[model samples]
Target: MSHVTDVPAASPEIARDHFLRRLSVETDCSDVAASLRGGEPDFVLLHVVGSPQAYERRHVPGARHLPHRDISAERMGEWPAGTLFVVYCAGPHCNGADRAAFKLAGLGLPVKIMIGGITGWQDEDLPFASGKEPGVLRP
Candidate 1:
């Protein structure tokens, strides 16, 4: 495992080192979508809805709901065995995703946090579903 040093230095080595470290265990929203399309993922996608009403309005496709306040041992099994997990919340500045990521990682599961969260996904022009996700590619 590469060491992740949270330094502010702008040296080329530092930036390269950071990128290499992140490459070992880092993924983003686009990766998740591509995996879903290819049907070859080893992980499940989870979206922690900060607000029930917002969740009802729209969310990522195929996301399983695990409210922030409701994540616990009892619900940890909601995820699949040996599956990597990706967690996202309302958006940036939202602790829901961070908390969920920490909790899943603590449970000894490989997990990735969508740093920008759902808001960032939307900002990037990604598709979302309201009501039912249909579990299919959206136009």
Candidate 2:
């Protein structure tokens, strides 16, 4: 076996730990869909942007809108303590979800990023809602 000095491979246990930790901070489209179906109260889903146009076009059903630039610890403090927030944005190419997650986490709120985002949801053929109506999406 040849080993590269610049890129050392992680041991199996280390890799598993890293992946598990990542899973704790990230969720996928299917999981989010299931949560919506079950109406889980442990977490709240949010779309981290203020663009009414984008929102009006399409977004996850039941996701609340919160622009990342406008997020604040004081504002977040109004939420019930220990409430986990699952945030997403346009898609994998967008860093909005990561940015929002970092901001919320810094504010001491539990946060998870919905991997793949709205684009991923659509790609998976998941239902999406448009307009200002929450939880009502066009199939």
Candidate 3:
């Protein structure tokens, strides 16, 4: 049999559960772009890696710079506990997004990873923002 069929696929119910669970914690570049382009995004988008200058040079428009190393409960308290955070990093090669998500979750905050990160954003030709602020997109 072809490698594709080497292992049977999960049943539809099982597949739905698996995807639903994944969707709960992850988002894609396209979805994020659409949300940003549409207007005010409901979730906060954060860049979880790089220096301030690097972020200013180029980053998903409206994304706030917040390295994974800097995430802390006290630092995150500026927003209400329920504020959902969507984090991204340099690309699939980077784990900074994962680290940030862990910290945010540890603080009992809602969080999700913007899958594909900057690389994905670039792939989709989405606009980026700069400067320091609410980790949100500029109008």
Top TM-score model: 3
Tens digits of lDDT, candidate 3, 1-139: 9999999999999999999999999999998888987798888888889998898888888788889999988889888769999999999999999999999998899999999999999898776766665444533
Cα lDDT for residue 45, model 2? 84
| Per-residue lDDT of model 2, residues 1-139, tens digit only | 4567567889999999999999999999888887787754468888997597888787899888887887898878768999999999989899999999999999889999999998889888899888875563322
Q: Show pairs that collide, candidate 3.
A: 61-128, 61-129, 62-136, 62-137, 64-135
**CA-RMSD of model 3:** 1.9
Cα lDDT tens digits, model 1, 2-44, are 3555645579988899998775455677776777677655677
TM value for model 1: 0.76
Number of clashing pairs per prediction, in order: 0, 1, 5
Best by lDDT: 3
Runs in model 3 with CA error above 4 Å?
A: 131-139
Estimate the TM-score for candidate 3. 0.92
Best-to-worst ranking by lDDT? 3, 2, 1
- Which candidate, 2 or 3, would have the higher TM-score against the true structure? 3
lDDT of each: 0.72, 0.85, 0.88
